[model samples]
Target: MALNYDEIVGKFDKYIFNTYTRQPIAIKKACGAVVTDVNGKEYIDCVAGIAVNNVGHCHPAVVEAIKRQSEQLIHVYNLYYTEQQALLAEGLVNLTEMDRIFFCNSGAEAVEGALKLARKATGKKVFIATEHAFHGRTRGALSVTHKEKYRKPFEPLAPAVFVPYNDAGAIREAITNDTAGVILEPVQGEAGVIIPDDGYLGEIREICDETGTLMILDEVQTGFGRTGKWFAREHSGIKPDIMTLAKAMGGGFPMGAKLAREDVAANFGRGDHASTFGGNALSCAVALSNIEVIKKEKLVAKASDLGAYLMEELKALDKDYVKEVRGKGLMVGMELSIKCEDIVAKARECGVLLNCTSDSVLRFVPPLMISKEQLDTVVGVINEI
Candidate 1:
């Protein structure tokens, strides 16, 4: 039976909450760097589902793993353990020298869980976050998120102080005895993909060391080869005390995790915190496959090579409206002098899909599997748009 997208959209409008300003078309299926609408129109996917599909859409290995795991076991609470969960955890910790892993459900949940763990370790109530940072949308995560529109209505966010990112002095000034942790993104994702100064991460690590503050890096968007590395920290050579990850970990499945040093993890003991669906068989299975595919396919190295090529192509573009093109690896952003919301719509018309962050910067985080020729189409669309 063929599903009618318009009928489903009508039904969705009747039942779903009006929270997101979604695109009009419905994506029925996707493969590699392309997604097809309900009417079967093929569009080049440069957004990669907001950087969540680093391995590409409906990857054969990921789909097969999910299928195999579903037949093996679907759901089991955190009280019980599975080999998939162990493999996923091992894969995560192996990426970084971090000591422990705490499984969760989404990027926001990982942030909340990491916040709780940090507070417990320091026994402090205050936190220091960077200005223009977006941790997440949940109450706890929202409290740390610094956007006024997102934070205004929800007053009295967790007792947190916002400091200017990349300013080591402001961080030092803000960190007092009561400060529990300082959480930041290596490169700001939602804030127009802002990159910090050269020594920002190392400086933050130093400040945390001086103040006994837990340093947390929210690598939700920057993790899993999106920034051309296994993790963005690899570029800086500074390992964080705690790091949160999600988005691409499950290859489109709902999964998030927090990696922390063993000493720091000692604060959260048995029954300290657990998600009903965290570390479930299905999600872990998918994550295991996601990691394996990234490894076997060598998407991490591909991301680096392709990212540099894309950046060069974007930078080489001669557009009066383009102010700059900057980002690491596959995570490139072009800041335009003019508003670009319509670029999303216009790009789609040109048989390409893109995303705009803030009011002017266009973000490009295509799948790691995209070939250089496919990227040429994406770049050509942007130049024409």
Candidate 2:
């Protein structure tokens, strides 16, 4: 028997916590860049699970890897050794310059681990974060996040200082001997895809060296080919002292990791920090396959080519509401002059799924494997709006 949208929504309202303002449609299934609702209406998925499905929803290789690993070994606590976990760590270390990888379950947990590592490594208590940055909602990650709406309710957060996103001078001025690290998103995702100046990250890297501050980058949304490179930091030719990753790493499964330089990571001894499900075999196997898919299919290059085309097409739109069109790779945003709540609703009604973040910016973080024809359809829908 087919369940109706009303029945699904009623169950959610009756049993689940009302945290998110969900769309009207009840999604029944997803494949590639499209999702089908209970009514069997298909919509082009531009949100891509908020940039979590970089290789598209349930890529065959990822699904196979998860199934194979699940049948062999689903999990063992971190106390036990697992070949899947060890292999995934090696893959991450080889992908970046970082020497050690600490696995967690989500981006927020990655950020939290990064913070604790920095403090332990530097013996400092203060951190410097950028304005409008959205690291995560956990208390440690929340402290460094800049949005007051998210932070105001959670008072007495970890000690931190907020500075303008792209201002090198402010970051330099904010740093003190007490500062353990400086954290920022390479491209602020929740702040409406705010891209920094070309040399901003490099400048911060130099300052961190001068002040002995660890440069921590929250690449939860911008990592794993979402930004044309393996990591967005590659665009600036800078290597952060610590990098936090999660979304897309698990190929639709839940996982996160914090990578750091050897000496920085050496500050912690065994049992200093741990997660029961952090390095589970299931997530590790799937993440390994996810990384393999990104490389084997050359999705990074695809994102670069298609992202450029999408940006150009969006910029060509003659809409009066458009204030700016900016982003890197598949993480694009169209800022509007006025509130865009109505625009989002209209897009959904027109068989397209879009996200409105920072109140007025229309965020389009579609799957990296989204087709040109699908993108054309998305643009046509936007044109009609």
Q: Which candidate gets the maximum TM-score versus the true structure?
A: 2
Clashing pairs in 2: none
lDDT of each: 0.90, 0.94
**Residue by residue across 1-385, what tens digits does model 2's lDDT show?**
8779998889999999988999899999989999999888999999999999989987999989988999999988887899999999999999977899999999999999999999999999999999899999999999999888889998999999999999999999999889999999999999999999999999999999998899999999999999899999999999999999999999889999999999999998887899989989999999999999999989999889889999999999968889999989989999999988898899999999999999999999999999999999999999998
Q: After superposing candidate 2 on the true structure, give the runs of residues whose Cα lies further than 4 Å from its correct spot.
A: none
lDDT of 2: 0.94
Count of backbone collisions within predicted model 1: 0
Error of 2 at 60 (Å): 1.0
Off by over 4 Å in 1: none
Q: Return the top candidate by lDDT.
A: 2
Q: For model 1, which pairs clash?
A: none
Evaluate candidate 2 by giving its C-alpha RMSD to the native, one decimal.
Answer: 0.9
lDDT by residue (tens digit), candidate 1, 1-385: 8768889799789999989978878999999999999998999899998999999999999999989999989887877878988987887898877989999889999999999999999999888999999999998899899999999999988999999888978989998889899999999988888878778898888888877789999999999999888999888899899999999999988899998999999999998898998899999999988998899999999999998899899889978888988888888888999988898899998888888989899998889999999999988887876
